[model samples]
Target chain A: MAISIVVTSGKGGVGKTTTTANLGTGLALQEKKVCLIDMDIGLRNLDVVLGLENRIIYDIIDVIEGRAKLHQALIKDKRFDDKLYLLPAAQHADKTAINGEQVKAIIDELRSDFDYILIDCPAGIESGFQNAIAGADEAIVVATPEISAVRDADRVIGLLEKAEMAPPKLVINRIRSKMMQDGEVLDIDEITTHLAIELLGIVVDDDTVIRSSNQGEPVILDPKNQAAQGYRNIVRRILGETVPLMTIHEEKKSFFAKLFGKKK
Target chain B: MSTKNVKLKGTKEGYTIVLHDVASFEEILIDLEELLLNISKQNNASTEISVHVDTENRLLSDEQLAKVYQLVEQHSTMKIGKVQTNVLTKEAATLWKESENVATLVTTVRNGQVVTMPGDVMLLGSIHQGGTLKAAGNIYLFGELKGIVHAGYLGDEDKVVFAKFNHDAQVRIGEQVQIIEGKGKNEPLEDTTFAYVNDLHILSFDQLDQIRAIKPKLGNQTGGLL
Candidate 1:
């Protein structure tokens, strides 16, 4: 069965689009045909983050409105021509132009052609959010370790439950293991306790993520970076492979290493 | 002129009608019959039309009423869907009166009580612990809602707000207005609050909630028996 996952967070700027781009790319790297959909209309950044901004001639709105065929709008990744594709959101239109049914129809068409369809949901719980989750078979709730992000994630969880899309998998992104060890930040256990969802994987704070994003390449593309390794582990877990979670101690070295001379 | 082909108009019991004035009722019936035959043949879908007439001066005998019924029956395409007197029950009349602008179920949070409303709600509490509260309508945090609060959930943006304290990390209504960093700290006023986007950015208490009440009401208005 094709797995459709929605990467959503109640709050904005908590690494939802970043995670979608990385995970989709990581899955494609694993030889699984993956398609990442950018549902954030008007302020679309997925194409930029994926380094396919200049290549998007058509977008999701065109496919839904029948202005363009589905195959015509799908931008194939130059890095992984046959394995990965991007369905960009419209830049000129707002979220109101599309609804849940139209999103479902688009995803249904994508199901038979790909192994994984990752929808990068808009931050707030509005029409754009609903449109992203309407056809999703599973959901990945991305959150940071801060109290505010966790609280927003909790609200999103409550909404998922009410929408009959409960118990979404959790990904605590940008976790600072050293901060948690030194009592400077909330730990994974504290967040899991409050969020009450199954843990998929935790992505530690790595400067490599920022650097890679600046370079217009996801960290997953860099196999040497610890954050890249973390994304790979997440992909393995999604593929049902029994990969052990990387120790927090290993992540601390990279943080200090980058602080000194190591190029992250 | 044949009276049978002339269309007729009259009151029958409680119903009224305007018929095609041809020559006689029989001629009118023949024209309607031909029209029905043409419609059924043109479209496979079932189509039907019916006419009834009653007059005290030219009271149609039982035989005449029977003739009209028989003429309608002869047109296979035309079938009478329903025939009923125009009378509404007192219960139905009252139902119509009660159906306008019913208040929505809202969960209200005030002082300490947390009441959920059927529509949307308002929050009136000091969310000191840095937790979060969300509602389907506009959220009005009367006290210092220092934690997080989400409004315009389920995609409703017309909902707005009022708040005395806005120290929360975020205040989101629909897709707009995410105050990640609390709006610093404003001097406590008798009644100060904030609303969602308008002609201006985030409307401050002095601008939007002009209802100079010090402590506003909060919590779900829906019945909370417990």
Candidate 2:
């Protein structure tokens, strides 16, 4: 049976889609069959982030409305060699087009084939959010190291707690190390403690994440990248592996030390 | 010739008309009417006497109480001041019991969650930022407070919030609110600290031991002398 997880952030622009895309691809790299379902509906971007936009002929709405079969709506990622697939959201229909029962039915149908089903939930606590979480066995709450994002994540976590699913894990995304060290922004400990949930992983703020997303490729495709390492660590943790959190300070120290040593 | 079913006594505030619980409603009404007429005639017509009606251990219906008021109004110099009863209805008893209690909760108050209490609250879990805990009376917190707490939510200014201060959270006592930004020139709040509305009507933070000097009623509840 597949473990379905919903990636959600109550506030917009906190990298829920990016986390979903990377984690889905990361699982595929581990030889696990994964399906990335974009629940953002009219504002779908998971297909674009995974570079499978041109390949999507049918979407989740089409399948939910009985216009297409479940297998026909799933867009296979060419890079994963049949290991990764995406059920894109309908760009034409609003979030109200689908309900919780329909999403649960679709997830139940895909359970036998996929090893993991990651639903990319939309922002806010609306019907779309409810539908996305209805079929999820677990949830990943994404939040940036900012007050507003953390506050919204806290609200989402509270909602998830009320749901029948297991306690949702937290992913602190877009962490700026310098700002955190200088106390300009909230630190990881502060955000985690305030949210009061188990911390899954932390992704460092890197411009390459944005560049790679614009290129229609998830940053996790680059194994050596710091942000990619963060996502990979989270994927390993999800697979029940005990991996130590990546040290951002250690990574920063080596690069500067090498340059200063060369100058001496 | 009729036995007295009602007696009028002088009190410091005014006169009190005590109705006999064992007497029939008709007998009490008849006796009360005759006694009020006599008192009205004895007093000068210019002076008005407002008397309290005390029904000892008697529960009167609304119509019965209204009848008593109507009888008192018949006399020109007499008027009803207040009505007193010793018995309570089930609903009123439940409400009264709730307002005198202190609820103890052990669960975490998460963001967007609001915990409201009829009286005081003693919470054992943390309140996350964006969460709120409010009470109609005082609040006694034993856990970490990172959210907003409103004590005396129904506007009873004497209520206080007793807890260790987290500098970032906000405290509200009645109409006064203090956002503890840790920026005030006053000494930093330590453990066993509390926030209350002071005599100046400003929200002030102080040590818990000083609660006796600030709100003596809170101390008087637990065998402390008034």
| Strongest candidate by TM-score | 2
Using alpha carbons, what is the TM-score of model 1?
0.55
Determine the iRMS, in angstroms, of model 1. Answer: 7.5
- Interface CA RMSD of each prediction in angstroms: 7.5, 0.9
* Residue lDDT tens for model 2, B1-226: 1238899888799888999899999999989888877776677776677889899999899999999988888765677889898888989887777788788888778889999999889998888888899999889888778899999999999899988885479999998898877543256547688888888999999887787888787765763222
What candidate 2 gets wrong by more than 4 Å, as runs, is A181-183, A251-264, B1-93, B107-113, B144-146, B182-189, B220-226
Best by DockQ, which number? 2
DockQ of 1: 0.03
Candidate 1 lDDT over A1-264, as tens digits, reads: 468999998899999999999999999999999988999998899998888899999999898888999999999998986999999999999999899998888899999999999999999988889888998988999999998888788777766755686459998899887788886888888788656678899898899898888778998998788778888899999999988878776433476777796754
TM-score of 2: 0.78
Please state the Cα-based DockQ of model 2 relative to the true two-chain complex: 0.57
Docking class of 2: medium
